[model samples]
Target chain A: MIVCIKQVPDTTDVKIDPEKGTLIREGVPSIVNPFDKNAVEAALKIREEKGGKVTVITMGPPQAVDALRECLAMGADDAILLSDRAFASSDTWATSYTLAMGIKKVGNPDIIFCGKQAIDGDTAQVGPGIAEHLGLPQVTYVQKIKEVKEDGMIVERSIEGGYEVVSVGMPVMIAVDKSINEPRFPTMMGTMKAHKKEIPTWGLAELGADEDKLGMNGSPTRVKRIFAPERKGQGEMIQGDDESEVCALLIEKLRDKKVV
Target chain B: MAVKIIAEECIGCESCIDACPFPGAIVMDDGIAKLTDKCNGCGACADACAVEAILVEETEVKSGIDINDYKGVWVFIEQRDNHIANVSLELICEGRKLANELGTELAGVVLGDGVEELTKYCFAYGADKAYLVDGPVFKDYRTDSYTDVIVEMINRYKPEVVLFGATNNGRDFAARIAVRVHAGLTADCTELGIDPETKQLMQTRPAFGGNIMATIICPNHRPQMATVRPKVMKKVEPDFTKTGEIIRVENSVKEEDVTTKILEIIEHATKMINLSEAEIIVSGGRGIGGPENYYLIENLAEVLGGAAGASRAAVDAGWVPHYRQVGQTGKTVAPKLYVACGISGAIQHLAGMQTSDVIVAINKDPEAPIFKVATFGIVGDIHKVVPLLTKKFKELKEAN
Candidate 1:
């Protein structure tokens, strides 16, 4: 089993200096994505049940090794990092293609698990795109892993309204949602073991990926522009002491706008 | 460009046969529609198909693409109880804008019983043309019946863009049509734009749980499809003098073919806090502490005569029902006044409520993102502020 993880800047905690529009990551700490923790937990559980190795893969800047180490401490058997300067600014399509090529180099496994979608990109496209690139069955928004069998696995998929139970053949890819399972804390012994474990780093050349499709050059979609949505018009504050009077004022305002 | 058809998987339901609007493009082959040379590669037939039989394949030329073969902006004018849904009207306003951008006509696809009078409303709302499909079978909102009639119209006249509301019925119909037509369908889009170069519809929406926004395009698919959330777009003001052509088509669905039954029509009594229809909302978050403090939220909501909402954290803490959660994982609300009490707005929570007309944040943390978006900020404890506000409102009412 191979679990893919990403180390995203803590966008929630980091403050952007209003004057410079630059992020302040100095005081902010990066934590594993809440959803990715579920993915790691799913992989660890599978490894424990099936007696196989769980390797964590990540493609990012050099600092992403910390995310891999966290995965290792969480009980992954091995950790691999795909770090290169050229990999920056990759869109979901390019990111998925690169990850797919790296997974190919790490020997085919019976299963692949990823967070339903990364917190930063939020495309949710990468997991499905990877499945399309790898030509394997993919189940997304998986809430529960009912059973893992030799030939296939049974899982419950989270649909819009409810859940559906599905069975897919082995060597399949599953993108899990946050509702899947609760992640466990890394033990002291496991943390010590991870500190001693040497992590192998791979580059684009070692992965043998098409350079054209591995970064911005390979992505078709472009972010033309991004700006905040326009704020609503000035609000009318109705001043009144009585409920009926306030209600009457609201009704009149709504009628003036013909919203009612 | 040539369109592909998956015949083996097709059920030969003839749903597509009735849906193809292009002349002589689709012919009956053992009750299933087959594409011929007359097919201009317009994808209305594929979208109208129900069993996922039709596939539209686009040919990539190094030079460019022709978008005029698919023209006009169409809004599915959904009606219930002889009244147009607010969402449908909202789409027409949006469609009118898109039509103007493309230098094309804006049209409305109205399908229901006694829909002739409804054409006037569509035109008044901004549609340049109205296509009506009226029959007794169309009186109710049934997926199969509605799909049959609408698909038949598309088979007759191909529209470039089709917009539907992201309501229950709209989503049900849109998904079935997109699958049948083999065209792309972008759901719950927050924004829409026309690619200046290709004249393609750029559908933008929050993907991966509101972490990021993605813009989707169906380069090859004809009649780029999308479903916009209600209240996300503004509805055009009705001009009573506006009028347009109403083309009525005969319905072909029989009562026997409908599989689902409308067992009962039970309407729940309107509640004081009708979140779906509320004009104002006062939401609380984890900072509210526990279930006991939810009373503070409820009291504030009651005084303001608004609905009470909770963040996902508060709801998951068992402090409130899941329906009250305001975030990416919950309902997206756009009310007149949104007061965030003790809610430190997470990105997910912001995605759901950021569109509120007026925002007021009351939190002890001055650095909260909710304060950034809020029109008015009170850096104080909600427990102290809410009670004060409630008491002030009461005193004001009594004095008046």
Candidate 2:
């Protein structure tokens, strides 16, 4: 099984500087995307039960090797990082193309796994994009794996109202949700081995990816501008000496609006 | 393509450093901006450059698809159990406006079994044309079958813009179709507009947990696609008197082509608490203290005849089920009334339900960001304010 992951800025740890009206990213640390961990954990669980190898991959800068190492420490069999200056500034389309090429170079695998979405971007496009590029069946937002057969597996997919039990064949791609499984912590021995394990970094040339579909030039979407959303306005603060008075005032105000 | 900082035009201003969302993508070197490998060609720095020092040079990769060939705005009318999804109607309403601005027709594309009657609702919601692909193979939403039919339709009749609701099934299949058709798709877009200058579809969505909003455009790709946020767009009242052309397309999707099979579907037994369809919601957060105190939130919701919700923190603490959680990772709700009790509104949580018509925040902390968006704020203990509000609301009902 091949699992795709991304290293993202811990958005929860990010803070806004009120005085400067800018993001205070100085102290904020980067971590493996929370949802991606669930993907890694799902892959590991399947490999443990089905007796196979789990390979983890990511496409980012040199620092992304840390994310790979963290996945390795979680007992993945191997890790690959696709990093190059040419691969910079890729949107979802380009990113998926590059990763699919990297997966092709890794050889055929029964199942490919990924997180539902990354916190930083929250696009949830890469997994399906990769599946299309690889010509594999895709099942997204998988909540649980019910039973594994020789040629296929039964999984529960989360929908709007409830869950749908789906039976998918092998050589398929699945993006897991956070409810899938609890990721395990790295053991001391696993950490030591992960630090020692050599992770090969693949570039555009190594992956045999077309340069036309590699980076910013390959991306179809372009960001015109990005800014903080404007706050609506300050709300009316219902103040009173006691809870009873405030509650009464609130009720009266809502009654006037007919929302109560 | 790569981002380059032209030293000749450099003014030593650091606006680019602040505007770039990717960490370590830009840094100051010798009083001038420099680009690192961390940059993901989003071109935010170039926009932020005061002196226009940053330049993004594309390698002139032609997509080979003629953008002019694509016309009209199409919305994928997602339906389940023969009932049209509300988000689909919402998109058709928005699509009518976009189609008008572009001087093109708005079409609703529906693919399902025995769903031809849904076409009338599409016309009522403002679609000028309806394309229906009805068959047994299209009975359920399987990615393979849905992608095949949708991709075929898109290829046959090119659309300049295709919109889908950013629901689980919509996102699941839209991504696949976008890739197959080589179209640019923006996910969970909160706003959609046509660029006045370029006349291209502009997709605007939140990034970095709603802290920043980015406006995106697909300049070179045809059929600019986006999965719109569920409740962000307003749906106009349906005009049943309106009529449209119904074009029934033959489905070529075979059962053998679908690799995944739906064994069973388990609908939520307690569907009454469906937050997305609720008119009012009372949500608790970390401030609710513990799971034992959750009844206060439930009681208030019960008194209001609405749904009980919880913040991500409350859900993470195992106080509530994930289904009842409200936030970016949870549900995006636009209820008529939203009462946030003890919920310190993080931007993530606000991204989910800030679109509610009326927001009432009850928190002890006056400085919480929840107050910024709340229509009514009460700086008091939720334990005290909640019970009193419940009692008072009940008394008002009794008096009436």
Native contacts conserved, per model: 0.04, 0.76
- Quote the lDDT for A111 in model 1: 85
TM-score of chain B of each: 0.75, 0.91
Residue-by-residue lDDT tens digits, candidate 1, A66-129: 9888888989999899976556556565677788888888889788888865655444556655
DockQ, candidate 1, comes to 0.04
Tens-place lDDT per residue, model 2, B1-400, is 4578999899888888777776687888898888886666667788778787889875455999888999999999998888888889999999999999999999999989999899999999999999999998888888999999888888898999999999999898889988888888999898999988789998998887877788898898989999998777888989999999998887688898888999998888763477876878999999999999999999989889898999999998999888788887777787889999999999789978887888999999999989999999999999988998889888877888
Clashes of each: 10, 2
Candidate 1 residue lDDT tens string, B208-327: 344344566766556678888767888777997999887777667897765433332323232444464467788999989999999898887787678888998898788886557777
Docking class of 2: medium
Off by over 4 Å in 2: A255-260, B1-59, B398-400
Residue pairs with backbone overlap in model 2: A89-B40, A89-B41
Clash pairs, candidate 1, are A241-B397, B19-B151, B19-B155, B20-B155, B21-B155, B21-B156, B46-B180, B46-B181, B47-B181, B49-B180
TM-score of each: 0.61, 0.94
Which consecutive 10 residues in model 1 chain A have the weakest lDDT in total? A220-229
User: What fraction of the genuine interface contacts, i.e. the true contacts, does candidate 1 reproduce?
Assistant: 0.04
